[model samples]
Target: MTKKTPSLISSEFFEPAKASEQVAPKETALEIVARLEKSLVGRNPANQQSPRPPTRVQIPLWSEDHRPVLHDLVRSALFTCGQRDARMDLKAKPIYALEHIKITYTGEELRQRDYDVYLQILHLSRGATVDNRQEWVEFEARSLIKMLGWTQNSRSLVELRETIRRLTACALEVTRSRTKSSVPVVYGGPLLLKYAGAQEGGFDEVTFWKVQINSEVAAQLKPGDYTRIDWQIRTKLSPLEKWLHAFYSTNQHPYPMKVETIHKLCGSRMAEIKFFRRAIKAALDRLTEVGFLSSWQLDDTDKVKVVRSQMLTIQDRESNNDVRT
Candidate 1:
């Protein structure tokens, strides 16, 4: 009798271990206020206009974390946490979150793996000419796989192609607002404009693949709007840890939030809150272990308090530029 072989691609594929946090140890009263003020300004610049492009659109350093603004907001549920079902791809789903935001995701039920692929595509686009038509950032598949930290193999390559297709096929409709009176801004569109491999053959036969960043989403990647994820630390976390990392990364100083609320916000599939609560502590612990978090814990009231370790936040970077002026 023939037996089925177990799949090697799992969230653990990217799970490795590491540690450190950069919480500012000492801060004068002035610095505290400065950070807070900067935080508020950096909060959500959805209402602001896109900055004018320079003569040459130089791609920022690949090391910088230029995440999609919508992904950052819907992160709690944008990519489902825990192990994913192999068959659950290309399905439309609604993620319930705070009233201030509504995100409609239609396409592949993105997993953490897809998250890497989407970001990798964007990172590669930094240097490529970008537009609505998949002026896809081009590259050789083997090198791209190695960069994603995936094992180089035919299966990995196949998976990489699917990852890109998933990214290409997805559409996001995100609505965000700071307050009821303030005008709500609608943002988002297809996560990607289009994508394809070199002609004659599909991904399998193409030596170079092209992936584009939806021009609309690419605009939001302006300086203050995006978060800088520590890829080294991020690559080492579990699905839950990665989600939590993004949720917290968007907030320079995370406030106390109910574990229950987080479970809801993260769009957890775990049927019970109690199970998610238990799982959360472990995930938070992983963040702390990896230095993405300074410290975190469930308090007596059941609200989790998180302190982040950041060498410099987007606000901090802008603040330095101001001081130089």
Candidate 2:
């Protein structure tokens, strides 16, 4: 008897109506993770990761004469331990007075590695949250280690600090590690004012986290350091990509500009610029489909008109600068 081989089903065989089902959905869990991860890193993860919600934090509450250092530290701890994870999943509600904030995996039969990875994230988060605190700091470290199956009381402030350092760095590293398995796309910078284009509610979730995290972390720092962290967060873009994309999107370079220009203008690492491009292009495509901004090849006169309008804007800016001088 001859063995049989499986043949592929080509699109030619599918009806027009059925083509949509064949196409993969745009939004996915990975996309959510990627977006949040970018926002966290850009927003100063160390500062933004807070325990309490923003609606509750009070700012300028500290008087110049007596700045409460421990309060600042508490604010940072709460924000780091709570806020970043809090905003993503509306289903995840706050439950207080619990010893360990246990994150259970119940939806699917996820691999042990998945649990371990996320557990590591939580462990490191706890370590950072309790950084420099004499009370409950060791306990937080121990609980975090327990979750990771690493049991030994040898953890020191130095060790905890190292853990915090590694964990924050790992957030970026681990993100890259996972990206290899998925389709690679450009990441537009953080959804800041400039790059928002037609995308509404861009960075609202991130901005919400930043504002709340800053106020909370402000309460937890070591006097001078507390102010430094909070102030930096207020001034800097969390992901940095949002500002870069805003720059590119504002300039109507027909078709995407040379990828290198994007990398240079945005000051993004190679991998990040790649993703930024994908995000911008994806957003543009989406906008075009919805009849927001029309995207077309340079061959068309209408497309040339768009480019000309962009050029005029640049010239106007230059002219304004000359006039000011």
Report, for every candidate in turn, its global Cα lDDT versus the true structure: 0.67, 0.29
Clashes of each: 3, 34
Q: TM-score of every model? A: 0.71, 0.18
Best by TM-score: 1
RMSD, each candidate, Å? 30.4, 29.4
Clashes of 2: 34
Worst 10 residues of 2 by lDDT: 188-197
